[model samples]
Target: MISTWRRRVAARRAAKKKSIEEDDNANMELTIPNHFRCPISLDLMKDPVTLSTGITYDRESIEKWIEAGNVTCPITKKILRSIEPIPNHAIRQIIQDWCVENRSYGVERIPTPRVPISSHEVKEVLTKIEDAIRRNDDESCLDFVSMIKSLSKESDRNKRCVVSNGAGRVLSAAFDALSKRDPIHEHVALHEEILSMLMISLSSPLDEETRTNLSTSESLHYIVRFLRFGSLSSRRNAVLALKVILSCNDQEVVEDLVKREGLLDALMKLIEEPICPTTTKASLLAMYYILKSSQSNPDKQATISKFLEMGLVQNLLEILVDSERSVCEKALGVLDGICSHREGRNKVSENVLTVPLMVKKMLRVSDLATELSVSILWKLGKDEENGEGTVAIEALQVGAFQKLLLLLQVGCSGTTKEKVTDLLKILNVHRQSVECIDSLDFKNLKRPF
Candidate 1:
């Protein structure tokens, strides 16, 4: 008993010693100076590399030190890292300096040249607009609009007119100044005054040049705000503005419309309104451009998701089944473009409400809608190898399988049919799922759908 107890005590001591050694190994420390350049490389000691037996690090450690700025020699008190860190105050000072350098005659550096109308002249338009607005002379406002419209469009007869004659720049500068000038307490007064003028004339039937200028303006916020005016003719003109702006294929315009935060939601509301299908269609095409443009980034993916959630898929599904074949085809093409992304597919799958809503619409609408609905359903119901059993079974029972088979029989052609057919075959392996594809005569269904 004594011998056994002694052996157990010895083993415990040995285990404790081993643990202590490991702890020391894990906590080994190295000294580094606040500022010390590397002797060999002249860089700050990033991962200080020593030779294999000479305390030099391996190549990977050197690379890591380069990246992490953590290079240090184990024995030497040296910091071999060098990075230029900008101070917050210094950054502010630099920006202030830049702003000062760019300013001319009290105006900010807008990078655009002066309009044909000079500083004194902008005041002239403002003075006339102020008087006309105060007197409630709608005709005077309209006449001024016509004059601005004409000057905005004069053909560039001389080189000097090329930049200044563009109405978009002129209007943008005017609005920018107006929006920035008023105090918060006076915003409402300014808002009503501006709205009155904008509604009275800007929305009127515009010549091509005026429309072009309005659409091409850099101030998209103003564009969106004015477009939301109470008059129908004005709203129609806003749509026209979007059409022209979109045609320019200007990335800045596209970014302002789609990728930016506030603009997308506003545009979406415009599209959602039931007042004008033409406007709604134009909004959608603009959205398509946004998705296709280089301006698209991860941030706007959420906006796209919102669009899909806001019954975009359902709306397009309706168009896809329109009596006009061209409309239907175009709608399908758009749907295909949207669903091509994995993220897009996941969004549709998660939107449980969409499946039933789409089905109801497909029942009454065009053949193409029904066919595409089938395709979309199949895509939604697909499961990975380990897909949840209950979810998989529920999808099978929800009449999704039958829709796929019907599509196979009636709608899809050649290669697409074959893909659908193979998918059905995989799904049919389960007995409950097998019944959903009963429309397919098992023996005769060897070829693609």
Candidate 2:
């Protein structure tokens, strides 16, 4: 929304479209106080920043100014040797306070911006974490965790630094330490910190040392413990770590992790738990990996039964009703994976919401998500022209005919086109030209969905 406002301001500036009085009148609709405007853009400062000249500006505008070869302060015209822009938190606080005070007038309080840790500070903390890891100092781990997690929330520059400069190793070591024994009530908070920070620090992928630590069965056993009894944040991070570990694609390790006692149940519980969106995605992705792994194993029937017992089909269908595109894609992918089994397919057939949402997602989300949604449909709609052809009936009722037709008319592959054509044929035969599919125009299909 701020970007839209900024674009309007930029367009007006380039076209010289409005006079001072007109601009002021416009401000009544969305007035940033004059003091809040950046001198460069004449728009409000979202990230108030100051340079060596004691003049403050928005970070983005001043950076562009420097990149364009401006060698001095925009306000003072004083020459600058360096273009360092320090965050003007004091000014930002005033802006936020003003917005809060004016909240009844449709003013949006700007979010507290994430402060970047200096490279010097990052190096210093990395050193301390590594030293503490060597001594197995839980207290030092606690001392550094808040600062480390804050840094991780900063730019990708800091995240890459954290991964490379031994913080990943330290926290993975610390995570392993905390999992060694059952926790006392007094130490549970500290236990939560170690696991949460490790989750964030290793949020991407583990370095070699950390990866090796994760590969151990004993280590995974403890990580699974976080899912059972850990705090919300801690459990969220555990799923994040599990997603990464599975991505390593060590078939044997995947099998081992899947077999960990209570881990699958815990992961299934997370799927049912109505938590933050990210944690939900993490759990979904983790379940995707586990389901995919279980498919390749000989004990696949047992695994599918486990999923059925956990009532994952109903839980996942509920998740799909309201999730982001990525989460929707993962939920569909897991549904596809588990649908191969009779129990899983029966569970899916029992849910009223499943087929409608599958129809809803076709071309409504990204192509990847659409592909997975289509796969789930194929699993349900195939070779069932009888009363059990509920998937076909649901698809027709919920507009899958037009959606699939438009999907093919768009740039779907030969395989997808075949699936959609087959489903359409089944639905058309059942409907006898009187189907109640939603009205849609094939010409109106949006690109890059």
Candidate 3:
């Protein structure tokens, strides 16, 4: 019995060795057919697993193998994997059948998907808002805005179209009705109550006709006032609405805005405020519009200079120093424009824009701030007044050269470094930046500085 057991173990070892040889030979001989696919995923198999009738693979695993198309069944060599919903060979036939089923001359077929909203439901909401308007109820108006906001949350496209179409048309009619009923209460002066509602209404993307009609209403004064100055909650809405109106590029609106009593003053005041960087940025944009429309007279220059004189360059530089990359980029762009425009450039030359101080501030901030700091430096370098070239190269302070070289090393890629190298060369050529490069390591620098 012991001899027979030993013989059985030896036979089993020999059988396993034979099987390994067969697998090695099989690996070399196997070839995949181009047309075959995995039956489960209908995709070309990769490292395909052969399954017995009882062995089942999970859907996710099968899908993964289908993505790698070389897998195959151990027993049957087949490639049955695909991403196409139907096989390419049968697609033409399937399309032909579908068209035949839907085809009929002059027939109007129903849509595959339908959305339902009753006219009564829309009328009900409009009536509620109208009643609220008639009673001069803030709570009712708030409720109406809430309902529209909720519907917008569900289906953005449908709700936007419906709200803009239905709410806008009805609101216009309601204003007309209010005027007809009580002319005294209607077309009232700017107040917080109506301003809040109009702010929300205009916030929606109004149709062109609705926008024009609403603009024509005397009630628009509330909107204009809110835009100039309002609670933080209402201010952004007002600003955006003003932007839309400005986008129409109406010379008359631009003229009237510049003529408005507090528009310029309010924007100038906001720019000097330390907090609300976002609001300040928006105000800057508005100021640009006002400047574009107003005469480039001494008054306009003084107003802008006052902000810069109030040390706006420092405030704007601080924002540029520690802002998100995109925000810093935009702020730098605005600074460049403000300093380089005809009026702005003259202001800089007068030392009101203060190139030396701006360069010092940039030097105070490290080079790691953002890549665009390089751009800011480059722009400042363009201001070649009294031989500044962007910054006054001839009169650069003792430590300015070191600061710029340090900035060139940080956040700059290949092209940016090349430009920096070129800029350094130009400065050296003028004999203003010779000692700046002498203190740095340049073992790997491809181009001469």
Candidate 4:
């Protein structure tokens, strides 16, 4: 008995230590000199500016502080007659020189400070670019794509101006034209610039018109082709652009994409072997939107089948197992979409790890992941099946009942409450057979549906 107890104790201790090692990361300590730190955040200032009250601060910090309606300077508590931040060039140069001198000590030079582009300036640039694209002037398009990219790099405000003033559509137009050209006839670098600009514009919040423009059948075909044959930048941008375009409610384009051979395969492969985290994230979201769209269009069962055939379930499950919270959230989202169909229901229910993996993710990750994972289990559990009872029974047998009960014990979204309640009933109906379940505990679940 003592030998068995010692073995169990050693096993549990080892498991606990392993879990801690997995969760912990090597500690990093960074120190910025006091004079170089922003007064507001006590961090190094990348863009120091002088306020009217005679104090220097990081531009972002002061702008936010003033915008929150503080009438006085944070340092002096003196009223300021003006709010424009005068650039503190002397301080920035000093910091740069110091960083350069300390380069071998792991010090990094700060980048050149950005200036926000004016809305008026952005409008002028857009007008010129639109005209060039309309005329299909290749050299002019290349020139404008370069100019736009430079402005986009200037500041986030400039990027927003570019997007809101219709750069997403304009850049995409140039991309579609260039991508359709024979490779030898194209200025390959120029072609890449337009693709990059479209990506930058799409990175910002997009309006409905810009969204619709990119969703055009011709534009989409080019974007999809980029994922297949374009460079890494092109593929990453295409991933983000397609994810954004999918959210635009363009069902016909989505349907067209579903029917297009190898599109889903390409996206799934990217997820299976990601170019980067952002690429993986965008690809997962793109697949989620496509799968979600298939539900309302009964004829698109082939779309769901196509994803399954491409090993999407396994791809998603693998990501959910090892990925971060964001990736797991999206993987669960796609899985939620999958469980909406019969074949998907079968795929999920028969997979042993799917139940346990999702159950483990429930409370272990973010609340959003909790919501998504619970919803997936709910969808799978509620589906009627004959065997060892329902999918809910299988979930309970796999220790999901404890996770759900814990989810309810702590707070969750109202929607999660509804899902957990319904799932409890499903699990309880077959509790007699599933040995781990306790009838008393099952009855205590708050089923306030």
lDDT of every predicted structure (CA atoms): 0.48, 0.76, 0.49, 0.78
Clashes of each: 14, 1, 28, 0
List runs of model 4 lying over 4 Å from the truth. 1-58, 65-124, 154-166, 176-189, 203-205, 385-387, 437-449
lDDT for predicted candidate 2 compared with the true structure: 0.76
Misplaced by over 4 Å in model 1 are 1-219, 228-233, 247-252, 259-261, 271-273, 292-299, 305-344, 357-364, 367-375, 382-386, 389-419, 430-449
* TM, every model: 0.41, 0.68, 0.48, 0.72
The sequence of per-residue lDDT tens digits that candidate 4 reaches over residues 332-430 is: 898999999989888877777787787777767788988988888887766663345556666777677777878888889999999999888778777
Worst 10-residue lDDT window, candidate 1: 82-91
Of the two candidates 3 and 4, the one with more favorable TM-score, higher being better, is 4
Let me know the TM-score candidate 3 reaches against the reference structure: 0.48
Q: Write the per-residue lDDT of candidate 2 for residues 1-449, one digit (tens) a residue.
A: 99999999999896675566567665677567888999989987888989999889988799779768899998999998667689999999999999898785667898887765565677788677667756767588578877787777677646755765677777676666655645434445656776677765675545678887776775687667777777777788777778888877778888787677888788887877746878788788887877787776767677778888888888888878888877888888889888766667778877888888888878877888788788778877773655556678777777787788778777777777787777777787767544576655333556655
Top candidate, metric lDDT: 4
Candidate 1, residues 1-449, lDDT tens digits: the string is 99999999999999999999878755665332323234444433322334322334323334344445454543464654422111223323343454456343232422222223333443466456556645655456446645544443442221122233333343333344444433523333333333333322343344455444444434354456545543554455455455556656666667666644555565556655634666665555556666656324555566567666666666665554442544444455446456655566665556555455334333334555555554554555454424643334544555545655656565555755765675566556654533432233233333343
Question: Candidate 2, residue 20: CA error in Å?
Answer: 16
